[model samples]
Target chain A: MILEPHQIELIGYAAAFLTTFAFVPQAIVSWRTRDLSGVSLGMYSLFTFGVGLWLIYGLIIEKWPLILANAITFALALSILVLKLRYPRK
Target chain B: MILEPHQIELIGYAAAFLTTFAFVPQAIVSWRTRDLSGVSLGMYSLFTFGVGLWLIYGLIIEKWPLILANAITFALALSILVLKLRYPRK
Candidate 1:
């Protein structure tokens, strides 16, 4: 099926919004509970770094959706990573 | 700075690779430990759904990078979600 440019952009925006904010709940949970035992340190470490790279790539590509999404995601992921480090499994 | 298509593609690939595989460690950890105390159910549910949208978006755009990355990521994220649901915290 053929999609107009605006439709494509909308899909991109939706995808970006979903992926970016999906980390919010995790961040909130980690913050309030101060428990990261079930969280994987390695995953957060790699994921945060990956999100940073995604931000850089977005900038280079000059795509607002990518830039905005990755920027927010990076911050959220970073916070989770910090929480994981701050509270290790007992 | 101006970047050639190849350079831009390379960056996209790298970003895709990192973000996609970032879930591996978490999946492995969850599978082994079966302790999801630190994992947030809301986060996984939202994230898996988001990744599915990403896959659809990638297919519509016909972007190999997005398609490949999101496809693998969806699988990995789904696995983690299943594990999260299967083993909830006490």
Candidate 2:
């Protein structure tokens, strides 16, 4: 059975909002504290690359849900990855 | 245009494997080092819940890409979250 249009949109929106907020706190804290001592650069690099690939997959499929979630996640992961490399908190 | 069957499977597999490996290092390091002094619990909690929701969404839609990536992510995130709470490395 086909889902209602609004229902699909709602799910997409919920996923987008949650995925975005998921990284916001970390982003804010990392930015504010400027501490990368505990963060791992290697893992964040892989994390960022993985999320970027996910975004590419979403784009190829033209799936909005996947696209939105991966896009936001990619950005956040990249931010963390950059901080990890640049700051390298001890 | 529809993607080739193998192509689709390859993308899914790639996404899943990458996402899974993405967290393996962190888990291993966290497990061995037991040093989460740099990890943020509040952010990890949100990240875990968000990935869990994505897994739910994947389950409902029967999307292997989302399911595999999110399942691995949720498991890893949960481990990190638990470690964060239980250990709270300083």
Candidate 3:
């Protein structure tokens, strides 16, 4: 079965929301508690860069889901990265 | 500039690798260090199920990047979820 552009967009939105929100709690918890024990510095660094690339890719293709999701994810990931650097596990 | 199927696949692959690998360090660190202080239980549960949905969506769309990325991600996320439950932050 072929899907129309809107249908595809719907899938994209669903995917985007799910993936993006997944990181919210991580960011909030880290910020509130000032804990970085389970966070990997390397991972967040790579992830922040990766999400930025994804945002660019999304813009190139004009996919709203990709752009919006990556934009927010980038922020969240960056925040966690900052926290990780600020408070290293002792 | 219009992109061919192959070009689109390239973007997908790039996105998939970056996003998927982003979680690798998290999983490995959590496993090795057995630290869950920074991990959010609600986040992982939602993420695990969300990635599973993404995998299904990818399968339905016949997109290899989505399928492969989500497959690996699901496993990694699930592992983290299990760890979250097994070793809650004290």
Candidate 4:
């Protein structure tokens, strides 16, 4: 069965929202507690860069789901990365 | 200028790898440290479910990028979730 374009777009949007919003609580807690010892700097660094690339890819393809999701994700990842850097887990 | 399908696929694969692999270090650290106090269970639950949905979406679209990325990401997320449940943060 062929799905409508709008339906496909909706699925993409839903997916984007779920994946992007999932990072919210973690970012908040990390910021509030400033306890990133459990968090990995390498992971956040790679994640941020990756998300940035996804955003670029989205832009190249002109897909709203990819663009919007990666935009928000990139910002969140950056915040986590900044926190990780500020509070080194030595 | 129109790009080849392979080139676009390459971009998708690259994006998927960066985002998916980003979790590797975090998963490893969380597993080794067993200190998830900083990790928000809500976040991981939402994330895992979201990734599962992404996998389903990938399957529906018959896109290898989403399929492979979400599959790997789902496993990693599951590992984190299990750890979160097995060792709750009090």
Best by DockQ: 1
Q: Individual DockQ of the candidates?
A: 0.76, 0.50, 0.55, 0.65
lDDT at B45 for candidate 4?
90
Superposed model 1: Cα runs more than 4 Å off: A1-5, B1-5
**CAPRI class assigned to model 1:** medium
The candidate 1 chain A region of ten consecutive residues with least summed lDDT is A9-18
lDDT of 1 by residue, A1-90 (tens): 788999988887777788889999999999999989989998998888888988888898788878988899999999999888888864
Ranked candidates (TM-score, high to low): 1, 4, 3, 2
| Interface RMSD after interface superposition, each candidate | 1.1, 2.4, 2.0, 1.5
Model 3 ranges with Cα > 4 A deviation: A1-12, B1-12
What's the lDDT for candidate 3? Answer: 0.83
Write candidate 2's Cα lDDT for B1-90 as tens digits: 788878976775676577667777888777777778778777888778777877877777788877877888889889988887877866
TM-score of chain B of each: 0.86, 0.78, 0.83, 0.83
Cα lDDT for residue B6, candidate 1: 96
lDDT of each: 0.87, 0.76, 0.83, 0.85
Residue pairs whose backbone atoms clash in candidate 3: none
Q: Best by lDDT, which number?
A: 1
**CAPRI category for model 3:** medium
Off by over 4 Å in 2: A1-13, B1-5, B62-68
What is candidate 1's TM-score against the reference? 0.90
Residue B73's lDDT within candidate 1 is: 90
